[model samples]
Target: MRLKLLAAIGLAATLYSCDDTTTGIGDFVADTDEITASAQTFEATTKTLKYTDLNPNGVFSRTSNAYLGKFTDPDFGTYTTDFITQINCTEDFEFPETMQDIVSTTLELSYSSFFGDSLAPMRVRVDMLNREIDDDGEDLGLYYTSYNPEDFYNKNEEALAEQDYAVRDNSWTKEEIDSIKKANGYYPPLVIDLDKARKAKGEETFSAFLKRKYNEDKKNFKDSYSFIHNVLPGFYVHNTSGEGSILYIGAIWLRMKVSYLIESSSGKVDSLVYTSIPFAATNEVYMSTRLSNSGDNLEKLAAETHNTYLKTPAGLCTEVKLPLKEMYEALGNDTLNSVSMAFTKYKNISENSANNPYKMGTPKNLLLIRKSEVNDFFEQKQNYDSKTSFLGTYSSTTNSYSFSQVNRLISQIFSDMRTKEEPAEGWDEYNTLVLIPVKTETDSQGNTIGLSHDLEVNSAKLVGGEDGEKIKMEVIYTKPKFNK
Candidate 1:
């Protein structure tokens, strides 16, 4: 009797919210006329995504760049990454250079954070690309994840520069860094010698190139693209040894400090001053990931309990199908208050050790996207809206990914049913939503501006099993209003 009364009151609320004229309860109306909300649990399917399908281009921003490291996990297989970036000279200088004038040269890489063993030693070899390629290339910068380094430049023949980077630095969060009293507590800059680079590639050395650009009739080394064409393509940084950790390389650049003799207008000569030319933001950069082995098994993880999962870097995702059509028919003339879901997270007790991969645990949040919009969402870089797009953050203490936007979504669907007849449009068409592991990008103020995926190279497990309290969706709905 109470259930019927609640349903009746809910129906009245829905009609009133919808501005309907005939949804009020009558004097003779019994408690049976009440409308009620229901909770439904469904099974989600897990699947693996191919490296080519991840759409890695432009997934990362300037602040949080790609990760560099190699990790061999017992269950997740071996994962390695190669970072390729193009740096262009800013504020061109016209000058002649002698090898003697070349002072200290370094390649600087700034990082925000890291994952894996901090004390573990890792070697990164930097190679120059001889071939002309851009992110748009068919098999170049933005090429497949299976891209081979040898295809662009043979490291054995062209070892330009290298560095042994420490992933685990005294890295702090953005807020902590902002609160620091010191002016220089930020991520320590990685500086490596690029001085040999000029001498290694013969006359193509950056010193000579700069001299030519600064002096004679320079036809080739005029602009950034021209410079890439005349001398070198770009640089590729990859792991040589150490599966200890993966460093989150934020922004990278090659700085060449050349000591040059600048003559004064007077007869007297001025002391030599160092001129630094950096290949920075002017050019394009791309990073690739190699899964190395067959550890990617999101579907298999679900088998132990019938739940779904959302991993990363071409790993896995969960597909959720909601029975909206059936629910729509049952609601009749009623409107919905809201709907929401809570997917439980699985705790990996075995990974609790102070481990490398465990150090950088999986996503703290996940995005629930429509099946049709999945492609555009990832490739185009879309954000969440309470209506069609929704993302929920996971609280380890809570052990569940709870989404509160479900009610609003259901209400919109109920409104759609009132406006149209058969097979509605937009979100209504997508009965299945994919729970994709993602890293959200936010401003310094902590307001999220965009969404990114597969760049972090992490994995996570979730509960989607049947015959238990797995993925729970609750719908608060009311009956339709009949005309007076």
Candidate 2:
């Protein structure tokens, strides 16, 4: 699944409040029969959003007025922004570059399929933010974090050695430094798993354990975000509702403005500066194509068994992804040249590595768990496994070529068009721009008798201009919101 994240304030609430809070606001004066008559209008409004009604917990309603609701002070409550986006196409082929311009045109058309045929509506949600302030007043963003606080503490022991290294001021002997380096893996853990420890002492919830643990190791809890030099943690959204769900849930992370007070003695945050972790909502459209029955089977398998891709063909199975180069050869036209030109330029600009980020395995017993836990489990397990898809190999490296690298090469066509000039030919006349090879088993007789089979490539069209002259491309680019 392609994941894009965006943040938004409550727009629906604004629309709703405007209707109910006016000076003349009052229950509508209607006859009981008139109210009953309004049901048709209510149902009509909801039918427009038939898909959203899928959530059993949700409600659909209609109202005549829109109103604004009281908001928590931005100073105290939360403030957020939703990223507004549009599909962009910039062509970069100029004069002689027009030879490669076909690639750019092809890319522009293909790009739509990469994300979707249409745009998704925006969405907003409230998330808890964590912040720290020093005694003198300074904001420190998150410096440390852990899936489990206990895991943080375990890691913290290693960080102490690094601190010791700094305190030694290079006075320590090489032998001493080596010993510490061996003992300490890296920095200290930012989140401590107090709950686990407290449980040993008869404590219950992990939240309660944190209070107990923090009090004992208060000295270690100083403003850590300041020392947080390399790593940052960001949230991986499992799923979201409202507009984000219009095209699957847009996954997101936070970028916050924090305030803190530095302690006079320890140089750590002494008072709360106001812990606000605000997210900069951004989104990218997901692009993928389903292969008729096989594709449907793949999706169902994932949903039913909590699996991803095709581990085993469940029901109907059909075509598989054809090779790009082979297909290019089959077309026996300028398609390869166009694709190559785009691929080369895309590499120059995007510097994309041939990695499949979406490849993942079905959880051991995912279907048995509650829906809410599915996201959390995947979040935890994602770090442990290598992603691979039966549709394609895990490594971009194939028996001879890197398909993803080639795709990246193809992506360049679209990228170039976005930044460069559009070709004079335009896209209306190009018809099909991309060609891929699909192989099938063949029964043949070698020496006119012995049996043997050979594979062959075929041409496939990806993009076109008004009359199908221009070509377009598409890609799924994942950018981390904060960090992890």
Best prediction by TM-score: 1
lDDT of each residue in 1-484, candidate 1, tens digit only = 0123246455556434532222221222324344343333332333334333334332222223656787666555566766666666433434354433445556687666666676688887777777855555344334334556677777677566665666543455656545541455436665666656656556365445545444544544555666666655777777787776766666677666767566677855565667776666343544444334344443345444454555555556666667666666655445455455777766651353234445446677788777667766655557887667788988778887778666455555556566666765644474666777777778999988888665565655566534333454555444433333
On residues 201-277, what C-alpha lDDT tens digit does candidate 2 reach at each position?
56353333223343444332232332111111111111122211111112222222234454456665454333333
Counted clashes in each candidate structure: 18, 71
Residues forming the 10-long window of minimal summed lDDT in candidate 1: 19-28
Deviation in angstroms for 334 in model 2? 13
* TM-score of each prediction: 0.74, 0.17
| Candidate 1 Cα misplacement greater than 4 A, ranges | 1-64, 91-100, 135-151, 168-186, 197-222, 262-267, 282-305, 349-358, 407-429, 443-446, 466-469
Return the lDDT, model 1, position 144: 37
RMSD of 1: 6.5
> Which numbered prediction scores highest in lDDT against the true structure?
1
